[model samples]
Target chain A: GAGVSQSPRYKVAKRGQDVALRCDPISGHVSLFWYQQALGQGPEFLTYFQNEAQLDKSGLPSDRFFAERPEGSVSTLKIQRTQQEDSAVYLCASSLFGQVIYEQYFGPGTRLTVT
Target chain B: QQPVQSPQAVILREGEDAVINCSSSKALYSVHWYRQKHGEAPVFLMILLKGGEQKGHEKISASFNEKKQQSSLYLTASQLSYSGTYFCGTEFQGGSEKLVFGKGTKLTVNP
Candidate 1:
């Protein structure tokens, strides 16, 4: 039983460039979530998906952020025209069945540095 | 809105006890507690549903007061391994499943 995993452990991007971070949820997981954590702060929700349907995106900071879970297993978070403020660690999590009370399994996360 | 966590930071000696509190301004449906070590993803500790159920894990336990929209995590005999940042994520009643998290409470346990 592998846990959730994220790719590109670290990414350095120039301001205004676009970057995409990937996540692989646990097998058979039906709920996936994305969050952003800045230094010295808690993780802030970004978006969520339930079986490929984007259920919640209200937590997204701005229009520049976009995410998708096309296959209901893997997901991607894309940031357009990245700003220095976008520099943070991007985390992905998943639960077995999208249950409100299910404990989410988290990925190692991808640290993005906008220079 | 994000919940507020008390005692932004705390220091404890091994075998001591500590409490971390989280409060929300709105009605809550569920509360989730998580711990994250430096450079690592947050690890789920326990969750309390709207029923105000109390849960325990090892020497760590938590109680949720649904009526007050607050939750408290209690750690007894704190271990060095318990040193990390604790975050409380709250799901408001009538809100989507998205969780709004508190800033976090940093706990440092020394031998």
Candidate 2:
């Protein structure tokens, strides 16, 4: 079975530019999560969606960050204004169920660099 | 709060054994383990739910001490393929849907 997939494995954007990262979850996954990982650190939670409902967004750093999963399958994380602080790897993960106990299958991630 | 992982890094020769530990201050409902190589996605190793349960995967195993809010991962006879960064994600009690991950412990297994 195909694992989670993220598009544009690498991206480079100027400061103050807008960027969008896409994620395609597994065929039957009901849960999706987004995380940000800086160099030499573990991933930090960004947001979570159960089906099409945005269940948790507290992990999002600021208002500039936004995410949506309208069809309960593909998800997009958009940043209104990119900053040097946002330069990191964005990871997407999906689970078969919406519960916290389920294992999450992660995508290869999209590395974004804001200059 | 994020969990704390001990021994920021470790190196062992093939066939050697090593242990990695994770601890949290808050009450935890479950602990998840993952292994990630450079520039790759994290691969799930196992999950240990509350009740101090223990689980195993291949030559690797883990134990969760719910009372102590801590978990330990044991690697027996480590293989070169086991070299990577090990992370522990903690899910707190009270319906926390997100995982707070630790800084990660890098394991290097040399043949």
Candidate 3:
């Protein structure tokens, strides 16, 4: 089977511009996650969703960041009025179930550059 | 919180040993180890559940300390293929499964 996939492998946005990153988790995965990784730093959790219901959004840095997984499958992370600090790799991941396992398949991530 | 990883970077000769430790202030239920090559997604290596269980893959093994909220990765007879950045992701014992990763330790193995 195919692994998780993200679109527009790279994006460059002007300051204050909005951008939307898309993620298609592995088919049938019940748990989806979003992470932001800065250069020279490890990936940081952004948010998470169990099916169509978001289980945790506490990691979202600010109100400009929003994510949705409608239909319990595809997910989109939208950053409104992006700032220079938002320039980082946005990673999406999916696990087979809830917090019962340690394995989570990650995508290549979308490298967003806010100029 | 971000775990603290020691030896921010290390260089090892083939057939040598290296140790990387990750410690957290919060009690953890599990610690996950991963190695990420340059410009790639992190690949999972192993997961250590709370408690002092040691698991080995090839000559690479790790130990977890539940009380201190710390973990260590041990690499033996290091091979050139082992060169990469190692990261420790911690999950609080009882919470939504989110991994709080530490700044990775970069390891370079020379033949």
Candidate 4:
């Protein structure tokens, strides 16, 4: 089976530009999550979705960030007016169950660099 | 709060053993371990739930201590393939589904 995957492995944008990163979770995974990882640091939570319903978004840095999982499988994280601080690798993960006890399968991630 | 991991980095030789520890201030429901190579996604090593259960792989093992809100990952007879950054993700008992991660422990195994 194919593992989790993300599109646009790398991206560079002007500070004020908007960017959208896409994620394709493992087939049939009901729980999806997004995270941000800065260089030499651990991944920080961003948001999560259980099917089409977003269960949590408290980890989002600010209003400039938003995410959606409309069909419950594919997800997108959009950043408006990107800042240099927003430069980091965006990671997407998924688990078979909604429970936190389940192991999360991660994607390669999309590295976003804001200039 | 983010859990704290000990020994920010470690260097080892093949056939040796090492232990990485994680401690959380808040009560935890589970501890998840992951290893990541340079320029790659994190790979799940194991998950330890509450109740102090121990899980094992060929040469890897983990233990959860609910009372202390801590977990330990053990690597025995280390292999070259085991070199990478190890992270511990803590899920609070009453917190959301998100897992708060520690900085990371970089492990380098030399042959």
Candidate 5:
């Protein structure tokens, strides 16, 4: 009955530092997605996974961003050498059947600040 | 590409009505509507599939004009609780797993 959850509700990193955000999807959710939301803007898709496979990563902003869902249940998004431009809210969502028709359940998201 | 949303923002008195529009340049498979309050996750409002489908949620409803590659979200008799940013997510014909969101329309309802 639990919804999606993310860790480190808030994170502050110095420029050039590295950060990792975690996402715990609802039980048995087969599809997971990550998005980035800049201030006053709609969320931008970053990556997506089906089961344990990273099906879509085209939306990732750069090579420095990486994501993994090795077990198909939990996922982690890592950023190497963070910059002020990387500051944003990182959101995670999951769906029951990996279908676009099903509504997604979103997490509270991790707000990352780069200074 | 991100869909375009009109009127970047809107302000209305309680019990008034509002309409938000989303238009895309490419063919779409489905359209999704979401509402997000400040510092919170987006909550799903409804979805409209291709073929000009219409769906309703409480006092809010949406219509998709597949032929025109556009969708409209209608909220009548607005309430304070409806104050938030509204986003329209478009799923293109070939990309079912991803959604491209519009810039969002800020809605403020005053009592």
Candidate 6:
């Protein structure tokens, strides 16, 4: 079976620009999550979606950061007004169920940089 | 909230034993251990519930302490393949699908 896959493995944007990172979750996975990993740091939760509904977005840093999973299988994380401080690796993960007990399968991630 | 992991980094010799600890400020429902090699996704090692029971994964066993709100990973007879960053993930109450991960501990296993 194919694992979660992300696109644009690398993205470079100008300051104050907008960028969209895409994630294709494994087929039928009900839980999808996005995380941000800064250099030399651990991955930090960004947002989560259960099916087509986003259950949580408390970890999203600011209004400029938005994520959506419309059809429940694919997700997109968009950052508006990107800043140099926003440089980091964006990761996507999916699990069989919405339960936290299940092991999450992660994508290779998209490295976003703002210059 | 992020958990606290001791010995932010450690070096070990092959066949030696190493222990990594994770502690949380709040009560947790479960603890998950994962290892991430360089340029690779994290691989789940094991998960331990609040109970005193210990879960073993290929000679790597982990135990959760309810009283101390902490957990420890025991790696016996370490191998070079074990060189990677170890992370401890904590699941809070309510099963909200949020997992807080530690900063991770870098372990370098020497031959």
Residue B61, candidate 6: alpha-carbon lDDT: 98
* Candidate 4: tens digits of C-alpha lDDT, residues A29-74: 9999999999999999999999999999999999999999999999
Second chain alone, TM-score for each candidate:
0.97, 0.98, 0.97, 0.98, 0.98, 0.97
Candidate 1 residues lying further than 4 Å off, grouped into runs, are: none
Q: Candidate 6: give the clashing pairs.
A: none
TM-score of 3: 0.96
| TM-score of model number 1 | 0.98
Clashing pairs in 1: none
lDDT of 1 by residue, A55-101 (tens): 98988999999999898889999999999999999999999987656
Which portions of model 3 miss their true places by more than 4 Å?
none
Badly placed stretches (over 4 Å) of model 4 are none
Which candidate do you rate higher for lDDT, 4 or 6? 4
Best by DockQ: 4
Root-mean-square deviation of every model: 0.9, 0.6, 1.2, 0.7, 0.8, 1.1
Summarize candidate 5's per-residue lDDT along B1-111 as a digit string, tens digits. 799998799999999999999999999999999999999999999999999999999999999999999999999999999999999999999865899999999999999
Model 5 misplacement above 4 A:
none
Which digits, one per residue and each the tens of the lDDT, describe model 5 over residues A17-66?
99999999999999999999999999899998999999999989999999
Candidate 6 lDDT over B1-111, as tens digits, reads: 799998799999999999999999988889989888876667778888888769898879999998899999999999999999999989976675788999999999999
lDDT by residue for model 2 (B5-110), tens: 9989999999999999999999999999999998899999999999999999999999999878999999999999999999999999998899999999999999
Candidate 2 ranges with C-alpha deviation above 4 Å: none
- Cα lDDT of model 6 overall? 0.90
| Candidate 4 chain A lowest-lDDT run of ten | A94-103
- Give residue A30's lDDT in candidate 6 (0 to 100): 94
Question: Higher-DockQ candidate among 4 and 5?
Answer: 4
iRMS of every model, one decimal? 0.9, 0.5, 1.4, 0.5, 0.8, 1.1
Better of 1 and 5 by lDDT: 5
A72, model 1: CA deviation in Å? 0.8
User: Looking at candidate 2, what is the lDDT of residue A62?
Assistant: 95
| Tens-digit lDDT track of model 3 for A64-101 | 99999999999999999999999999999898887725
